[model samples]
Target: MKIERIEEYDERFEKDIIDQHGAYVINDETYAFQVLDRDTCRVTFSNRNDLNEAIEEYRFFGGHISCFVDQNGKILKEYDKVSFFDMKLEDIYVSQFYVSEEKIKRLLPYVKEFLIPVAKIDGKMVSLDGHTRMKIAQLKGISHVNCYYEEAGDYAKDFMEEAQQRGIFHVYDMPLLSKEEYEEKWHRFCDDFFEQRKAL
Candidate 1:
């Protein structure tokens, strides 16, 4: 993924109805807009400088912006309280890794194929580290679900710890592997994981 330095926040109005609000702002924006049918509002700033400035403003103001939007896309006078912890799947980055075809064939029958639970960080939605599961979810028209706000560094460490604890050293943290190595090993692990699951 392309990492750009953020500088300001750009605010724009949406023409959608707020159906169910999520727990937190998915990104570093003041308003976290969640609309009906699982659609979300994306804020586009002119540049990274402006984006960073906006983020800083939001952080200074208590790390959140809460408001209620009506069906006509109007923000109601009453402010809704939202926490930073209530992040969505869209906010996180997807690691570049390949899912094995064998795993897909094996898990296809047993897995629920909807809203695959990825990783969670302190109870908030984070990244879709599982490439195979994400692809499957998309193919099936299922929402990719996860918890929020985990630093990439911290996530790398946690992933390593979990793998080591579970004796899954073969599937090491993505950061530790070279891009090519990650692709090969991830595919192998995906196949083996589903194969074991099927055996049970």
Candidate 2:
């Protein structure tokens, strides 16, 4: 899908989000929760009430909401929450972006004998997203990796470009796929591996 690029500092979308307060209706019933700034976009919220219950969750989890963009670059009616779940050891794939020579040296030994819960993303998974836990898993040989199934759409490219422009190294690119393609591949992978699954 093609998407028009909006220049940095464009206030239109930001204004729209803010005008709607903390929640913007994407479609008839689907809504995207808005946080005031970038820092608050990374937190995981188990429920909508979680946003009001704590400042940290509001700041981190409510920050950036995901929405589909049409070819015209207008935000579409459907959107998704960014989330992940623990997967068994064998189903996870090590990201090419995060795989460095030193990381390899450190990670391989643990991979040999245990299941480690690393974050897997089919789209641009930010460095700040789960960098700490991944490092700890690498060093400690922890079991169960958190896998983020890439949500297919053009939004990830924009997010990645913005991230790069801001000098965020932890956010890295993944192969783009449409939403249907992503779901198909994920189901195929799950069936092939016979692994237990949960959605975050």
Candidate 3:
């Protein structure tokens, strides 16, 4: 739950990764996957409905959450930095949706337990979850936050291994986006997604 807010981006690393491998990079030393752009969220959940569902279940594993208070009595939340790119955005048409900002604002006063997910690595705290809550806190100008640390483990490796054992290949693994496809499709997908959310 305790995470450092990013003050800037390493444009150099981002450029290098995009130019060299068509991937986006996070400067692990100082950056976080804090940008919650629709594209990035789509990439994270892309073609991974099972994982998205798993995340939803995992989110409530514990009924209680811890909060941190700054000297000014402000509540803080946890946020993490992550990487994003085109390959990551493929087949993301059916991922889970995000919590509405209005909902968060409305529930803030009644929230008794606020969860901020983090990984503890050799005494250093790193964010593993709760981007939406953190963004809400930032918008509210509440700078105090806290979290419970989970031991560092190879979650991605373990998840993928289990997936491979079960013969699960996400849709994104199949093919690269043709330039025409990206131009004609991705934007429309985003537009449709927002419209649907608005209707909801």
TM values, all candidates: 0.28, 0.24, 0.27
Q: 72-150 in candidate 1: lDDT tens per residue?
A: 6554433233323332334433433344554454446544422322344454333434445555555565544433232
lDDT of candidate 2 over 1-200, digit per residue (tens): 11122212233344333332333222122123343222122222233343333322222322234443333444433334545555543343332222223323332432322212232245433322333234445446565555544432333344344445544433122332444564565345545434332331
Candidate 1: deviation at residue 115, Å? Answer: 5.4
Each prediction's RMSD over C-alphas, in Å, is 17.9, 16.9, 19.5
Output candidate 3 Cα RMSD: 19.5
Stretches of candidate 2 exceeding 4 Å from the true structure: 1-79, 97-133, 151-200
Best by lDDT: 1
- Per-residue lDDT, model 3, residue 5, is 26
- Per-candidate Cα lDDT values, in order, are 0.38, 0.35, 0.34
> Any runs in candidate 3 off by more than 4 Å, and if so which?
1-113, 156-200
For all candidates, the clash counts are 21, 10, 7
| Rank by lDDT (best first) | 1, 2, 3
Model 3, TM vs. native: 0.27
Positional deviation of 6 in candidate 3, in angstroms?
32
Candidate 1's TM-score? 0.28
